[model samples]
Target: MTQRSTADRAVGGLGPWLPIVLGMLTIFGPISVDIYLPSLPALRDDLAVTPALAQLTLTACLVGLALGQLLVGPLSDRFGRRRPLLVGLGVYVVAAVLCSVSISIEMLIVARVVQGVAGATGMVIAQASGRDRLDGPRLTRYYANIAVVVGSAALVGPLLGGQLAAFMDWRGIFLVLAGIGTAIWLACLTGFSESLPHDRRRAGESSILHDMRSLARDRAFVTPVLVIGLLNGAVIGYVSGASFLLQGAYGLTPQQYSYVIAAGAVTFVLGGIVAGQVGARRSPRALLPVGIGLAIAGATATLVIGVLDVGLAALIAAILAVTSGTALTVPSATTIALARRPDIAGSAAAVVGVTRYALGAAAAPLVGLGGGLSAVPLAIVMLVCTLGALGAWLAIPRAGEGASGD
Candidate 1:
């Protein structure tokens, strides 16, 4: 049997196990991101860095995620998905262990960069594998399913990390992550099989430099890619600023902060579920605005409320609206982005992936400009980001809008 057929049988033959495996793999990045959030405050004290500098740790991870996908996407196209994933997860294991042992903040940052780079492989590969089999709304549903898993991780990882850090110290968080990496690595070896076959592999490929050029030139490809990136970038912005916004500005305790964060995350999960249900019924172009609208309204309201010195209850309600809106928007954009060119889904997804995280990484510093923890600064930053995302999405033409065919 052909490798593609074998993979199809392996993946398509099993019903629940396939998505479960994909879900686990998808959650790896979220775990890497959220698991460390609760530890940021403790690390600030231990590393003796300013709060802004401490925030760079998260930025570093995001940068790593962006760059790693840039490398892994093409490699997966050439070598198949499974091999690079194994290598990436293996690297993550080492980085996680190194993070645990680091004596200085610089070392920890470097280790996190490595971990982010390696951890992103799972994300890119899981996407490529999903694209190899599914398309259109079906693929959107798959992404929604993965989001639920990843979203749940976002909810749980921080709480777990917070409790762990509270009791055991921040180093323990990294150690636990290392253990999770080991388990995921083993799962890759046993349960997961290659989806991209050699016969289908892109032959005589351009240099990585040239592939980037080609990606930039494809407008149909680039539009949806940009849409996904910008939307995801907005989420990353929220993540980058969330800790400071809650703990530093609002004066919530770490444990309390996790619960607050959990509330936002639950909205994210709800958004994904809603997207899966409605993505087919609504045009992606139409849905993109919903998220942008929510973000704009939420951020703008928060800005006004913060200016007026609103209390916690009001602030939470506004933020939840934005979160809920983002949840609805992301999956639909992703489904549209990957609709065409089933063959290069890895590279396609990677393009959007890189843009999202890269923007997210930048969002950290941008939001820090006014004041790291203050209310007005964060509200303004989120307002601009959400508005920007809305403009970007509106600029792009959809499949049926002007284009003759899909």
Candidate 2:
């Protein structure tokens, strides 16, 4: 018989295909949101809905992704990771199918919400799993690797979405999403063992309130979560405004805009890898301030360039710095927060997920204010967010710079 070695047998270390599968799960929300963006006009026309009504589909997904983490995280704590994740994947598949078959905008919108919730399940569980099994440098490294994987997903989702739209209608994209969910569900059945054993399980909803209070009281936990969330707010603002900044002002085509964003994402991926390596040698905290400094400089440049209407090259360089800097900060902050409360990893990861999405949604609209004809507003949003993140980082406890940030 073959040796039955896998993620289950590996403790305190990620096994083969572990990060890959988790990366795939982590991309669920991104794929759901980005893969169908090109088909919005077609979907709107087919469902006979106004542009604003059609846009609600996107809003529904973001809201669901944010709030659903609140539900999934605690459940995983109560019942172990395996069953909840499997159930979530099943629901996601069903929701995607429902989305694909919807005849009205309302139906599609509801289905998309369900899809987002299901996506959140995988996302939170992946982070919880990392915290459950790993610690120290390994913990931070896994998260950095996840950042790289997610960057690749973000870069590819739009390109794939644009291509899929050329060949078929919007429904086909949902089918593809369903297909992706199904494959991941199958992988889960085989690859995952209960990381949070029954003995460690807490009462799901009953104790969640207590857990939240405890997490809120800890400065080490709260500060890092703020850093992660605020940096993500800056990122979402950059993403929301980039198209307008590039396509509207510079007159770049959609394809060209994508290419420019893809370049930034490549830098993001490289930054994550470099951060992970440095974190392995030092602690995640060792490089945290460096990341913040880069982000501040980049955001400052972006704000100035937007006001001055500097050359496209300078603007792209500034944006890329922001992208790479954010990448460096995220995994470290995630590790610090998660490493603080391994016992309630699910709840902790849940809070982080919720903050990121909620703040991201709040920041997104700022990019479009005043007709969004200029990049000044988006640059301002980014600058404020990065500065906020820096302030939060400074508030973190100063005693754990050499350790796992516990």
Candidate 3:
């Protein structure tokens, strides 16, 4: 019989704490983005920039996140997860401080890009580490738990940011983020052990291009990656545009918008819990159609409501549906994609991360391009993205064929 790997041993030794720790690490992206959202209007005025330029700050971060994952994922595959993670967290702390002190919109945009690059390390490694230890049904459940943590952070980050913005200025928010990054850095230094052992590490000379080619040829992997990208695009597009829609167009305050966004986030948590329970009894593949269908329904409702000029109640219900669908879809799709090649989990996780963030970066700007005041543009873009996700899901083979089709 084969002996257990370090990751397997760590899973047994750490028990419940392992997933929690990974979840905390993975939340860096959401917290960083969401916490700054309430300040976007203030930041735009303070920096004396155009609305489009202000939106670029957010777009720049998404682009950096996508590019950073592409670099760090392959490195983690060869060098192990711990050192790169620690270094990235350190950079994140410094970049947050830079953002706090930025004197102009250009400076703030550049700082956000660097901050996102550093934060991507945590996002990529956390998922890669999960893939290191778990597989099959267990992997699906682990991802569900991670989704709950992410959802909780999404719920809290904006509310806290709005409160902070009310109490102080936007600069205080970045200072708080700096403090958070510093704490996470120390935790990683002291508490986290290297999950990928030397024996399992990819050979130094292995070609990343070859790995990309291999993954591209695998329809199972490609389909899920596309679906993940499109779903995330819809979610982030909502996030990017919601502040302007609610606060600028609908005349809601930042505090009120935060409460609305937080309420919507709760549905995401509910969906995650439901997916966790359902995934155990059914194949993860079976969950895909239901998830995509809900997303389509939600997006369609949002478009219709926006065109009709309905009030916030109708809009909130539609947004809740979309977020819940994502909660159901992302974990299941991620588990299927990452399980395809356990040895190259980091690379696989990176591909998914890059695609998701890249599309999200594209979607953020589209919401503002048609004019920042209307929710109609945001609704339309989300509808298109959800439909794209559904199309990608359909491209995969039937449920019993296996996610990887190996």
Give per-model TM-scores: 0.86, 0.94, 0.88
State the weakest 10-residue window (summed lDDT) of model 2: 1-10
* Candidates by TM-score, descending order: 2, 3, 1
lDDT of 3 by residue, 205-301 (tens): 8888877777877887889888889998999899888888889988998678877878767877888888888888778887888888998899999
Estimate candidate 3's alpha-carbon lDDT, on a 0 to 1 scale: 0.85
Q: On a 0 to 100 scale, what is the lDDT of residue 111 in model 2?
A: 93
Model 3: residue 152 alpha-carbon error in angstroms: 1.8
lDDT leader: 2
| Most TM-score-accurate candidate | 2
What lDDT tens digits, residue by residue, belong to model 2 across residues 31-110? 88989999999999988889999889998988889878999998898988889999999999999999999988889889
* Candidate 2 stretches greater than 4 Å from native: 1-13, 204-206, 400-406
Q: What's the number of clashes in each of the models?
A: 1, 0, 0
lDDT of 1 by residue, 1-406 (tens): 2543555765553255666667777877778878777678888998888998887887788778878888888888778888898999999999999988988889988998999899889898887788776665677777777777777898988777767877877788889989998998898788777777676777765566666666676666666666566556556666667678788888988678677778888988888887777665655556677777887898888888889978878888877877777777777667776665555667877887887777666665676675655667767767777777776676666546553232
Evaluation by TM-score, superior candidate among 1 and 3: 3
Measured with C-alpha atoms, the lDDT of residue 7 in candidate 1 is 53
Better of 1 and 2 by lDDT: 2
What C-alpha lDDT, on a 0 to 100 scale, does residue 264 get in candidate 2? Answer: 78
